[model samples]
Target chain A: MKNIFTGRDIVSDKGYITKRNIIEKSLQLFSVKGYYNTSISDILAATNLTKGGLYGHFASKADIWQAVYDEAVCIWRERVFSGVRDRTDPMIRITKFIENDLRNYLGADVFEGGCFFLNMLVELSGQSDPMSKQILRGFVRISKLIQAWLDQAADQGLLKPGLNHKEIANFIVISLNGAAALYTSTRDDTIVDQTIEQLGFYVRQLKA
Target chain B: MKNIFTGRDIVSDKGYITKRNIIEKSLQLFSVKGYYNTSISDILAATNLTKGGLYGHFASKADIWQAVYDEAVCIWRERVFSGVRDRTDPMIRITKFIENDLRNYLGADVFEGGCFFLNMLVELSGQSDPMSKQILRGFVRISKLIQAWLDQAADQGLLKPGLNHKEIANFIVISLNGAAALYTSTRDDTIVDQTIEQLGFYVRQLKA
Candidate 1:
């Protein structure tokens, strides 16, 4: 066997088009019905792809799930990091990052399905899925990203001197995640606005 | 044709005993596997009950879902209210309520599944499901409870005289939910501890 189906080429190839379609449809279905609620048949119905077609790319439902999660996390990291990267001020960059997230997640129909990582947090809290571990690792990665941003801001004298960086970082991340949860639950724009305002207040408080 | 199925009677009866058992088991399953992932057969296997026995109380799988949700919400309300009712000082009561909730949710293996409302919120964000509506209503009820506590605390000179009660209440409720999200995702005790600390700090800021 050639085993030509091994890496990025697998996803980049035309033959793997079904795999990409499966991931896209899976993201939509999983976002709507959730990871557990969405069946293989549901995916098949959405994509009009046969089981063999799906199985050809992924080993099992869990394999497809891991792919969907990886893709979602990749998108979130790129969007969030790129959104705030150009700003010189740490506070402004943080705010912009949050605003960008809100706009993407709550602004339009783009994320009317809610944040994928947050959803996984709820759906896989106690479940022993490899995907669950991946989700937690994603949170740590994101939290570290936020912490790094805050550290830069502090180093530049943008944030209050003596502010506990790790604590504040955790606070910001948890608050943002909480805000996302509230927005998802209410499907109300007000929650997102309140979150924005709260973040603003916290940012101001960070100034000397 | 007696229509003798009173909610209480059915909940307490023998034949309906298995029905309730099935619902409880289904809740665990659904919470873990999600609504679509767990089938009737899965429920049967979990509860060791036959189809006829399962259908004795619930007319269908949807009925079982509704019953499980109702039961979960009822228990959550009791837990929240019980925590709130014990303290006279609104601020202290609110703190205690959150503390109790954190203790209960984080301590127990069962609630480690995350907030049922939070879970459903993500699962049904843009969809029209009776369970979704019910979850939203539950959030409203919780927000109202927080508002009432804030009002009472203000009256008792526990809160700042001119604080926006509704907004504060909203922030608190949303933050608490967010905290629940963080805890559920990370399964870290520190998240809950940090939430309590931040909440306590916020409450102190509200003191008259």
Candidate 2:
């Protein structure tokens, strides 16, 4: 059978749309109520799909959780990370990554429901599930992005001699995630702005 | 009815112990699995309590969650905040609060599972439950403690002129929480130490 998602089959277009619909709706609920609190019935109710319709699209709640997490990471990479990738200057690149991607895209606006990756980290970190592994992989990816930039900047002699790039990257990631959590609770935009500002100050202090 | 918790009967002492047992065990699970994922059955399994015994103590999972939250906050305040309260110097108090209460008590060792307050904040914020309200109150209380110290430090002319105490307090709270979340997943002791060290640097930069 041709898949409607790929326009390969007109017959299965409805099936593809139905599956996409379920995933979209599930992502909204999972990001807000969380994966555990968000019940299958909640997905059905929100999607206005009967039990059969919901089950037809995703076999189980866990299946939909995987979809949601994958989609979230994809969005962060394509929507957020892509923009920050083109800058040639490491300092400018890193700062923009923090300001645009970390502070703006991953901040309260795109994730007003809450950061899916961070939510997963808090909710599923220690569990030996595929979900936990994927979340950890995302952390490593982001940390490497920051560390690479810091290392490049150090090579360019913009930063002080003997700077610990990995430690600095960890500091930035820890602070950004922390800021995101605080902003999620308080809905205080200042926290986000202040985090970026403080991070900038830390970087400037490292200048040669 | 005479309360077993009040030692009205020998049988009641068992009841009190049973109730305490449920809360303590639930705290561990909730810290990791979170409130929603942690089913009553999980509690029964961990505590080896019968369905009726568990139900007798907590009407529902929500009830046990409320009790756990209250107990977590109480412990943080009494055991964590109390030590920081006794310091006469605002600088010493704030520093000790970061090192002793925050770094030692609420850091990785005590919160290897997850930070109870932060876990609740991430899981429950914007949910409109009494639990969410209580968690927000805890954030406010901690923020106030930090702000009070910053304000005093500024008044004592120990800080750089024209400092925004509220913003600084917000920074520290955000960073501490961010550090906690990172440590939860990585189990990296350096994250905890670096968080304290970075916080100290922030404070020293504020000093006159």
Candidate 3:
């Protein structure tokens, strides 16, 4: 992990940290004020970077936004995905995946602003841009990951007969995003608990 | 219904229509670009109104936003709520509410961008402002409405024994917002269908 707070950076980590600093600062703003509301000047003021300094690292505001999004995905993997990535049991992995996102990833450590991908997804929807397409790809990737686990669960005979893993995965993804949408705005932990409980109920019902 | 397209204002409806025009245009921009991203200039250009003319109706951008949100609530009543408002049966009312929101409201006619309340809630979360509080009130209103229906269902022995209407309402609210988050971004009707199907399943399980 790049140390974004250190005033002085080591020779090897300086450039990387500087870039990380810009991305982190811009992300905080973008997640809060949103992409269009956030300006280059806002990022510069937040990061204490000159126009030339910021531009040297990022060509434009859009460039910085892309980096922020990439970093957000990395944060998801490190904070949420990494926990479930190595689990051998598909059911456990799926359960852990949902658990981590609801209990931790959507919590303050990962983002007080809530799920970054979902935020960007809704914010950038209907836009005809590379960024928009890229966001869509991110959702597709996450959906595929969930669906793969669900398929494996079926193969292992862990699911109820005739159950559709694809639709189940869709339900998990949709409901989780919905829970985030509510919890993110409400900052109400009970909402998270309720959503998780319901999800757990669904998973248990799929037991053979 | 106020005629939004007419250039010549009917005498009694002149002031009402002018305010409606500003609200309508601002709602469109706020729906697409969000509240903070939208500027007064953007609204002016969209409405073809001079600054003074616009200010005559609203004092500031925030004022316009408040109006936009109010208009959004009104739209909700007309398009989604009105269908379920008069129904005395709790189960049928809840079903109609969800169906109208998913099938009609979240569809293109009501908001090509998506649910205005959800958008604002997510966009305005964690902010220290009147707008944020207003948005919170909107969510509370919806949640209470859903909860009331669930409570009625429970009282009438239309629900599963030991069922908790509070949690169920929370689940419904969270999941519906989730569906909107996905459907808004994907523009896929199938996602809506899947969410509705799952919700219907939940409703069916509540039967005694």
Candidate 4:
């Protein structure tokens, strides 16, 4: 039998679509209710699929989580970085990335609950499982991206000579996550506006 | 009967002790595993209590959650505010609060998983239940404390004129929450140190 959940085979075109549909529904459920709170039965209920049907698509909920996470990363990258990918100026790229993240992705509430990664990051903080690693890996990837840009800025003599790039990257990540979490709970867009403005000021101040 | 979960009547002294014991254990479980992920069975296992014994203390899991949250709040206030509560200088109170929060609370890993309020705030972000409300209220209480201090500083001509007190309070909160969440996930002490230093700088900068 063909399988889309695993990369063993191409799977049938219809099977691929069905798998995608399951992933999409599960993403919403997991984003809002989180991984542990959301169960296979919830997936089946939300997808309107029978147990046998859902199991046929993904071997387990963990595999489905991996697939959902991959989809979220793609959406995050496309929405937050697509505009700045071609920009060579590091400050432009960094500022635009923060702007896109704050205004477009987080402020826009791309996911029903909020940023998929932030919600899952807090949800999976202490777990040592593969599921938890995936969330941490996403955070590392973003941190690395920002660190790379900061290093690039330093190489170009745009950023100050003595700043710790990694710490700065972590700071940006922490502040944005905190802002997004608070905004989600409060449903106050002003938090988003203030965060965007403040973070923007911090980013610009990083210049040489 | 004397009831601790609900203030109805007095039960046995053993009952009150048992109730307190359950709340303490459940606070650990819920801090790490979160509300929906932790089950009544998990509580029974952690506390080594029978199903009937557990039921006698809490009307439901939700009630247990309330008791645990109240206990966490008391602990939080006592640790994070006890020193600053006696100080009259707003900046001293503010910096002392942040220092206690970072150095003593988060940096020391006072809770096994991390800050209880940060964990629960993210866990319950989108929910509208009373449990979620309690977490949000904890956040609001903190924010209000900071904002009130900021306003007091302004009145004393210690804070820079025309600063948005509410926005500044939110910034400190957003940054600290972000810092704690990241620190919890990474188990990095430098994050806490850097956060304290930077937040201290930011606080000092707020003065006239």
The lDDT for every candidate, in the order shown, is: 0.73, 0.77, 0.80, 0.83
Ranking of models by lDDT: 4, 3, 2, 1
DockQ (C-alpha based) per candidate is 0.49, 0.60, 0.63, 0.56
Would you give me the overall lDDT of model 1? 0.73
For candidate 4, the TM-score is 0.89
**TM-score values for chain B across all models:** 0.86, 0.89, 0.89, 0.91
**Candidate 1: segments with Cα more than 4 A from true spot:** A1-13, A16-19, A50-59, A153-163, B1-20, B110-112, B126-128, B154-163
Runs of candidate 3 exceeding 4 Å displacement: A1-12, B1-12, B82-89
**Where does model 4 exceed 4 Å of error?**
A1-11, B1-11
User: Clash number for model 3?
Assistant: 1
Model 2 has a clash total of 1
Q: Residues A77-196, candidate 2, lDDT per residue (tens digit)?
A: 665555677888888877887787556566636654667777778877676457767786777778788889988888888888976777777777787788777777767677777777
Model 2 misplaced stretches (Cα beyond 4 Å): A1-8, A48-59, B1-12, B50-60, B78-83, B86-89, B101-103
Please write out the lDDT profile of model 3 over residues A1-208, one tens digit for every residue: 5446765446647777789899998888887777877788899899998999888888888888878988898888777776697899998898888888888788653765777777777777765347767877877778788889888888887877886667778888888888887777777888778887877766776778
Model 4: per-residue Cα lDDT over A38-85, one tens digit each: 989999898888999998988898889889999999988888986898
**Which residue window of length 10 is worst by lDDT in model 3 chain A?**
A1-10
TM-score of 3: 0.90
lDDT of 3 by residue, B136-187 (tens): 6776778788888888888888877887677778788888888887787777
TM-score of each: 0.82, 0.86, 0.90, 0.89
What tens-digit string does per-residue lDDT give for candidate 1 at A115-194?
77777777776765566778777777766877888898878877767766666667677777777766766667877777
